[model samples]
Target chain A: MNERLTYESLIAAKLEQLAPLPALADDIWARISADLDREMPTDESEAPSGGGPSLPGTGGMLWPGLGALLLAVAGLLYWYSQRSGIPVPAPSPQSVPADARPASSLPADTGSPKGIYQQPAAVARPVEAMPVPLADSAAAPSTGKLPPPVLPLPDDSRPQPAASASQEPPPGQPPATAGDKASPPPAIDTPIKKKPRGVTGISNNDYRIVPDKKDSARKKN
Target chain B: MNTPDEDIQLIIDGCIANSRKAQELLYRQFYGFAMTVAMRYSRDEMDAADILSHAFVKVFKSIQQYDAARGSFHAWLKRIVVNEGLDHIKARNRFDSPAELDQAEEVPVDHTVVEQMSAGDILQLVQKLPPATHAVFVMYAVEGYNHREIAERLNISEGTSKWHLSEARKTLQQLLQSHR
Candidate 1:
């Protein structure tokens, strides 16, 4: 019992040691407690009922505008398709005309303007006939001797040489005088020796060709 | 006696029903005691008042869970208020210096000296303690809790609670001694 008394005394001492807190203003308590009496709904089902009608009123106005926007997009797509000229359904080969088929499918010569084979044959015959006529014209000119096809006249507008001067030698040496013509100067008969294969005669060999051995010996002296 | 109990019961019931009048009465009746507990754990008068008001709101909201058989309504409410004050200190991340505990054993605190000090002066000294130590000290000394009860309330070890209390006592002794 004394221990319990001591304990109580200790508690009293501690409480005495503590400062009393300042009183809270009544307004603060009133605000806090006032919040407590306000209910918070636990689920949507318990949520206040009036909030949904306002939303659909705004939502209803949006639908027709969205539909008009969709129709405008579709119209734009159609106009684009027309402008680009894309065939909606492609034309098949079977739809083409028979006359448009190529000529290779016809009989070998039947569909050509003349016969298909005859056209090239006819064209080649004309080319062959053309060269024959050209050869005939050339032969006719030679055989007929047509005055050498009228020799063209020389257009000699410049001066001409005197006819007598063609026979005269040029004026540098004694004109082949009659005295030097005796026996035609022994024919000078210098036998030109044929050069041996691959060997050319030098200028000294010209003197060795003199027929008079005496003249050659005097030349050496 | 029955009238007071019935009156308290009516207020509790009215609070559960979300009645504003009963909530206001409840707040008024307990505000002083709760704020006193709050001031022991708070740094200043305004902080004590703020904590007390918040605790009353929690009490009114959770009044449906209050069991009269376990304790007096006021004591339960006071516990809620004390816990709210401790939470405020925690939320603010207030901590006392660990050096306060280094001289824990040697620091001399005479209970008689504490007894002689006015309640206001003691509360001021308590608020000067680091938050953890002040909280343990208020729970153990002022609120009449054992180390274990303080540990449970503060979610700390019993050893931690004792350490805080000892540290708190040392600091308080130093403060009070200096005042001498």
Candidate 2:
């Protein structure tokens, strides 16, 4: 009779008796409230819980529109180039002229095919009127010599354009001291003569001479 | 004065109306029953509490969808709690591999032995069983789910469900014998 207590029957009997539960209502409700508050929308404006797919917006069109714009711009450029009949220079080994081969004058490593496409490190540009490069020309007589190094002019040493025009000798000419005979300086206190001129179109009638009142008073006294 | 069914119906209506007071009332009403179902499937009381709380949250969210014509709210709530517990067990990845189903040997227990045991003692023993076996045993013996239903819910074969049930029984019998 005691053996008749099967595991199923025993489990069923135990399950019938409600097991003592720890106080979980307040804690469980707190969790529920927190979770619900976090998930549930506060406003009625929330999208209905139908959970349907949203309609596409301009945001989706942006990438394709951008791609089309790029394609159109490229097509317009290609059309313009074709209509102009301008030969678009393609990068090719044969396109490089034999006379344009100055890469040997560059670094030894730059003599490679890649260097043919690359611009020389030093490009010849008329940066200044200074005779400093003449000194380099005086130093290097070789025709294959590299271009003279362009030295930066010091701000203080560089002559102002107006000062150079009025006072300095022309760039190509030597200084007076550098010549065979040194020129004498002009007298510092010499009063310069004033030359009155006439307007070319209106003749001398357009020129009105206003006398300095202070000068006139000094002369009168 | 409203009858118990009327009172419950009023509460249900309130819950559907998104009334916090009604939701709290419903949660408090079924907390014990929910905990009991959850505890049998969980590793500990905290785990059981977590399952209960999450299930109640689900209940509150989907209370509008609950149809009373199908069954009582008690059955509905219990089903939710049991499913929630099962989800937790599944998330633990306990059912990925099958347990030693063939090695389980049944041990006989006297009627006096189970009579002397408390529900808490039985729950402890059940909790000590392997996760899949514990779930299968609770579903078959306590929740009254058939082998086919258990297999469908657990995504296992009916034979596997029976094996887990037998293993659970053997483990429980051994624990009971040791306890005595």
Candidate 3:
């Protein structure tokens, strides 16, 4: 114990020997007892065997599953629109202001002698810039309903019924004047549904049922 | 491998069972050592008392986690008290920056200075150093922690830890000479 008091070891040894404040022991023990009582958990249901509340489990998975399903639906919608070559509409058309729409999306004002040619949008490309053309401008009836003959366009892939362009001028060229006369309408763009190979020979008669065996003999051809 | 006192063992068993008398007994038995550890790390008696109280609460709650494989109950309790001291320092932001470390002469004080002064006087001089330097001195010298361990615990560089310890030694020497 009679070692030289070097600065390194001196402070450590001195600090250890120094006594703390009087009654610090009593004060600390009082506080510890109070804390122990407060932390003891009065209600049995409120406490777990491990001395804490158990984490809620069943409710956690539902939201993630719902979110995944929503994500998958959104992905399917995006994929279908991409596959079908359809121009998906804005998420909320009514919520957006007219001025907010892009320049290309807006249609131009047209006032020619031929008048407005409104085409059915189902079989047509949804290009808002291209005006509809009449199938036969001269032969067009002044009044009464007439379904414009939707002819098939020359396409290597799916057989699409396109607007007949015989009466109208080819697209992207100069607009034809009344003196130039109207050309035939262009071919339509409808996708023709092809019958699958497996169900080709099945007739509708196979689905039809006779009321009874004698009832089939009484039926007229 | 010193055997524990029968009374201490009985008190510990009672503490584990949440007996109030046993807990109080345990607290009274170790409060001096705990207080000493706390006071050494703290600036004032009040802060020391606070750190001591906090350590006891922790010791009581986590006493179950302590095992014979680790070390003696006293050592385990000392570890908790030291940790509480560190926490107190951290919470108060008591550790001053290295830039604030005082520049003291490298020359050692007279050999008889410590013999002439009480241990309290020396500790008071230690407390006079920047909190950061004091903590390093206590941890490295008293607690036997290396600079690397000090750096890891205090979230500082090893160089910084070394600087604090060096600065602490210098200040203590100067304080010793001044006290004489």
Candidate 4:
């Protein structure tokens, strides 16, 4: 009879008789509850219980450095796009040719004095500027390379009678072809003007700009 | 003393309400059972305590997801605690077993031998088995998991799970015979 003890029945019997547990340290729950208070409210769900789909937004544990890497990449893209766009230089008012004036650039609609494209004398005279891209020799402003073909401006931006607005490249017109004619060749001999000292006078005591320790050290190096 | 059902319900409600007193009561009631389970998975008592603490914290935090309709709360908690222990062993890379068990003869033992043993006395015998073999036996035989579930938990092939179970039974039979 003593030889009949199988492994399965023995395990079952032993597990049935519960073992005594030692008392936990007094400070255990106190530390656990304190840690829970800080970390639980924000993440009531992501406690890593078995057999469920994992939840998101554990910035430290789940993703580790992923959130920081994503933020850095986004910041770089924003800075690059903003920094790449240089402002188009406005042509001088006096230097513009009379033919370049927007009023004469497109053929005026003769059908109605009140034609939709007709701008009121006090309001938008360049209402007719919509159907046709404003075409004039000197009216369009050019920056650095043929600036990206200016999209047709909304009627709200009334054409300046003195300065020609930049024209959009016509269909079948590659930007490079139109750009070569419009772009003024660089004047290499043109003297570079030194930017004048701050136009507004300021006392040195107005503010202190302290360099960060690392930046200052790099500068000295 | 509260009836078992009433006590479980009260503890569930208390934990959901975030009452520290209720959590303490709940821990006191279940801690022994958890320790017994944890000790078998771990190498020693200190490691078992660490695993139990982590499992209990998870139990309290995830109490809201538990539905009594699914099964008894004790069964549900045991599953979580067992998985927690499995994960701890897996994290330390201690769960590997050889692909095959050499075919060994099964020793005959009297079923009455189990009636003579206390739970602590049996745990001592189990602790003597190699860690890998002990884990497989406890998971398959004691915990009532099938070979596939044990395979998944232990990160071994289904065949390997079966082989470990075989090795564990053989080793236990020999140990049991020696003690007799």
Q: Name the top TM-score candidate.
A: 2
For every candidate, C-alpha RMSD to the true structure in Å: 40.0, 18.0, 17.5, 23.8
lDDT of 1 by residue, A21-134 (tens): 333457666558445535422233233344644444554567788899999998897765444332222112222112221221122233334222321222122121222222
Which residue pairs collide in model 2, if any? none
* Per-residue error (Å), model 1, residue B22: 0.9
Candidate 3: residue A58 Cα off by (Å) = 44
Superposition error at A51 for model 2 (Å): 35
- lDDT, each prediction: 0.55, 0.63, 0.61, 0.60
Give the CAPRI class of candidate 1.
incorrect
**Candidate 4, B49-150: lDDT as tens digits:** 777778878888988998999998888888888988888777775655666543323455565776677777778777777777778777866777776787
Write down the worst ten-residue block by lDDT for model 2 chain A.
A178-187
Off by over 4 Å in 1: A1-23, A37-221, B94-106, B110-112
User: Can you give the DockQ of every candidate in the order shown?
Assistant: 0.14, 0.27, 0.29, 0.16
Ordered by TM-score, highest first, the candidates read 2, 3, 4, 1
Candidate whose DockQ is highest: 3
Cα-based lDDT at residue A213, candidate 4: 73
Winning model by lDDT: 2
Rate residue B146 of model 3 by lDDT: 72
User: Tens digit of lDDT per residue, candidate 1, span B1-180?
Assistant: 569888989888987876666777887777666666677778887787778778887887789999999999978987888789889978876443343222224344455665666666656666787877777776766667876676687776666766776676567667868866
